[model samples]
Target: MKLFFSYLKSHCKTLFFAGTSVVIFCGIFALDNLPLSAVGYAALLSVCVGLVLIAADFLHFRKTHFQLLRLAKKVRYGLDGLPPAQNRIEADYQTVLQELYRGMTELVTDCDCSQRETEDYYTLWAHQIKTPISAMHILLQSDENENRSDLQDCLFQIEEYVEMVLSYVRLNSDNTDLVVKQYPLDSIIRQAIHKYAPLFIRRKIALHYQPVSFTVLTDEKWLLFVIEQILSNALKYTRSGGSVEIRLESGNTLIIADTGIGIAPEDLPRIGQKGFTGYNGRQDKKSTGLGLYLCRRILSKLSHTLRIESEVGKGTTVKIGLESTRLRVE
Candidate 1:
C-alpha cells in the first residue's frame, strides 16, 4: 500500500545500516570454514550491497520529502503565522502536524462567522428596543411640566446611548447597510438638523449650515448617524447660548464646529476609542464614551474618513471627509 511505502521510506536508513552490519559480522565469523578466496569475495560483496542500500535509502527519502512539502503548501494557505517543522520525512510527525493545521484553520473561520451572527442579533435587538424607547418619549412629551423635565432629560440620555449602541454593532458588518447614491449635500444636512432639532432648540444653540448645493454618494441613514454623533457631542459640551455650526467646506469635507469646552491634548489621541470618555467625560459622568467611537466605526464603513481639531477652552471641530468622489468617473 502507498501508506506502508511512505512509512518505510522514513526508517529505511536505520534498517539498511543494521542489516549490513549483521551480514558483515556473520561473514567474519565464518571466514575459517570457507576458502580464503571465497571469504575475501564474500566480504567485497557485502560492502558493495551496503553501499547500494545506503544510496537507495537516500533516494527514497528525497522522493517522500517532496510529497510532504507539497502537502504543507496546501495546508498553510491563508494563515498568518505558522510553526517551523521539527522533523523531515517523519511519518507520525507529518500526520500530527497536518491535523493541527486543519484544526487551526477551522477555528479562525468559525470565530469570524460567529462574530458576525452576534452582531446581527444586536442589530435586531436595537430595533426592538427602539420601539419601547419611542413609547417612553411620547409619554414624557404628554406631560411637559417642570417636574417631568428632569425625567425627560434622563430618558433622552437613555435613547442616545441606545442609538449609539446600535450604530456600534452595525459598524463593522461585512455588508455595508449604506444606501449610497447621488443626493444633494444640503438635503442631507437638513435631515441631520431636523433629527437633532430638539437639542439645538433646548440648549439655545445655533445650528448654522453654509448654503451650498452639491451631490455626493453615501448611505443616507449611516451618514446621518455620523453627523448626529458629532453634533450631539458638540451640544453636550457647549455651554447654553454657545453655537454649533455645520459647514460644507471644500474637498468634500463636512465640518461640525462647537464653541464649547474643548478636549485636552492628552485626551485627543484616544477620543475615538470605544467606551473612552477621557477627562471631559469623566467630569461629566453622563458621557457613555461611545459617541465618537461609533462615529469612527460608521465613517470607516462608508469609505469616508473622520478627523478632529481642537484646543482647550476654544472648542472642537470634527470633519467627515466623503471619499466617494474618488470613485467618480471624470
Candidate 2:
C-alpha cells in the first residue's frame, strides 16, 4: 500500500494534466454535433494513462544515476570498501551499483592474496636453488686451488645474491614460514657470527661478543638473516682498527654496536625503506640499500622491534627487542 501511494505521488501532476485534457475532449464531443462513441473515449483515456506511467518510471530510475556513478568510481580506485551483491541484472541503478562495489572488493582481496603467495613461492624457489648451488661449489673445491679460485668466488657471489633475493621476499610475508620455539638466543647469535668469521678476519675488524645466554621463542632462520645484515653493515662501515660489539642488554634485547662511519642524521629515518640507502649508501655506492630494509621487515613479521642510534663519523648501534612467553625467567 505504501509503494502504491509512492507511485501515485510521483505521477500525480502528470495524471491530473491528462485527466483535464480528456475531460475537455469529452466535453467538445458532447457539445458538438459529432456522436459520442464509448470505445473511442476509452481508447483515448488508455493512451493518456500509458504516457503518464512511462514518464513516472523514467523519473524514478534517473534518480539513482548519481549513486551508480559513485559506485563505479569506487571500483576504479581499487578499494574493497563495500559488500557483495547477488543479482546484477534486472536490478535498479542502485542495485547495480551495489553489485559492482561487491565484485570490485572481492577482486582486490583475491589479488592481494595472490601477490603474497607469488612472493612466497619466489623465495622458496630461491632457497631450493641454493642446495644445488652448494653441491656445485663443493665439487669445484675438489679441483686445484689456483685453477678454480676465481670461478669459486664468482659462484659464491651468485649464491649470496640468490640468498639476498630470498631474504627480500620473505621479509614481507604476512604468513611468515617461521617456526617459533624455545631456543637459546645466544647460540643463534654465535652461529651467525661464525658464518661471517672469514669476512671479519679479512677486514681486520676486532670482534667482541659477551656470553649472555638467554632463551626466546623466535624463528631461527629469520633471526639469522637479521644478524647477517647487521654484521654486513657494521663490517662495511668500520675501519680496520675499529671494533664491533655483539652483546645483550636488559636480558630482552640484542645489541650490535660498531665503531664505524655512522648514519647521517637526515638519512636515518629513511634507512629501513625498501631500496632507500640514502646519503651514506650513495656516497659509498657499495650498499644495496636492501640490507637494513629487509632486516626491519623480517623483524616486524616476527613481532620484534629494532631501534637504531648513530652519530656521523662516530658509530652506530642497532638494538632488537625480542619479547615472548619463551623468554628466560630471571
Candidate 3:
C-alpha cells in the first residue's frame, strides 16, 4: 500500500495533466455540439490505459526496491553487487556505489594487514621475553638463600604473566593452533598440578586430586591453559590453610572448588568478563581480570562450558562441562 501511494505521488503531476486535458477536451466537444456519448467513451478508454501503465510501473518499482534492499544488507560480504542499472540516472547511482565498494574493499584489506603486523610484533615480543625469564630462573635456582624461594615465586608469577600475554595475543590472532585429539584427561590436569605444586606447598594448601580415568577429545594445549589459569586463581585466593579439590563428576564434567575467600554475590556473574575485577580483586590489588576470561574463551572453542558458583568469604566452585557435540552420554 505504501509503495502504491509513493508511486502515485511520484507521477501525480502526469496524472493531474491527463485529467485536466480530458476535462478540457470534453468541454470543447460540448461547445462544438459533437456526440457527447462518443467523447465520454474516448475519455474512458484513455483513463483505463493510463491505469494499466501505472500498475505495471508500480510492480516493477516494487521488485527493484526489494532487490536493492537485499543487496545493501550483503554489500559488506561482497556476495553480490547492486542490481543492473535501469535508466541513465540509475546507472550513475550504481557507478558511484561501485566506486564506493572498491574503496571499502581496499580499506578493509589495509586494516587487516595492519592488524596482523601488530599482532605479530607483540607475539614476537612475548616470545622473546621468555628467554630472559628462563635465564633469571636458572640464576635464581643456582643460589641457596632465605630469599631464593620468594624470588623464585616472583619469577614464577612473571612466567605466568608472560604466558597470559602470549595466550591473549594468540587468542585474538586470525589463525589459532588448536590440535584436537583424544588423550588421557589426567595427563593435562597433571601438568597444571605439577606446575603449581610449589605454590601449593609454599601456601600449605591441601590438594585433593585423584587420577581421572578418562580420555577427552580436545585441544590439549588450550585446555591445559584453562586448567592452569583456574588453578592459579584458586591458589591466589585460598588462604594458607585452605584446600582445593579437583574431581570429575557424572563422567562428563570437571569441578575445581576452592575453600578460599569466595566471590562477592554481586561479582559472581561478572567473573569471566574481560577486565572485570570484583570485590576480592579490588582488595588483593593483584588480579588482572584476565585469567578467567581467557579460560572461558578457550573452553568455548573446545566445545566445553564453564559455570561458577560462589559465596562471599566461603569459596568459589568452577565447573567445566567436558561434553562435546560429538559425544553422547546416553
Q: lDDT per model, in order? A: 0.78, 0.78, 0.89
Please give the distance, in angstroms, between residue 84's alpha carbon in candidate 1 and its true position after superposition: 19
* Structural similarity to truth (TM-score) of each candidate: 0.70, 0.64, 0.87
lDDT of 1 by residue, 178-234 (tens): 677777878878887887787788778887877767777877788887887788889
The most accurate candidate by lDDT is: 3
Q: Give the worst 10-residue stretch by lDDT in candidate 2.
A: 78-87
lDDT (C-alpha) at residue 259 in model 1: 92
The runs of at least 3 residues in candidate 1 whose Cα sits more than 4 Å from the true structure, single-residue gaps closed, are 1-90, 109-117, 325-330
Itemize residue pairs with steric clashes in candidate 3: none
Candidate 2 TM-score versus the reference: 0.64
Over 1-330, each residue of candidate 2 has an lDDT whose tens digit, in order, gives 555567667778977987797778778777785665764777577888787777677565454444455656765764343333325643365466667768878988899899888996897899799888989888887877675755764675577678788766765556556787777888899988897786677668999998777987788888988898888789878999899999999989999999999998998888889889888888877667887888887787677889999999899999999876433322
**Candidate 3 wrongly placed segments (more than 4 Å):** 1-34, 69-74, 77-80, 326-330
Query: Which scores greater on lDDT, model 2 or model 3?
Result: 3
Model 2 gets an lDDT of: 0.78
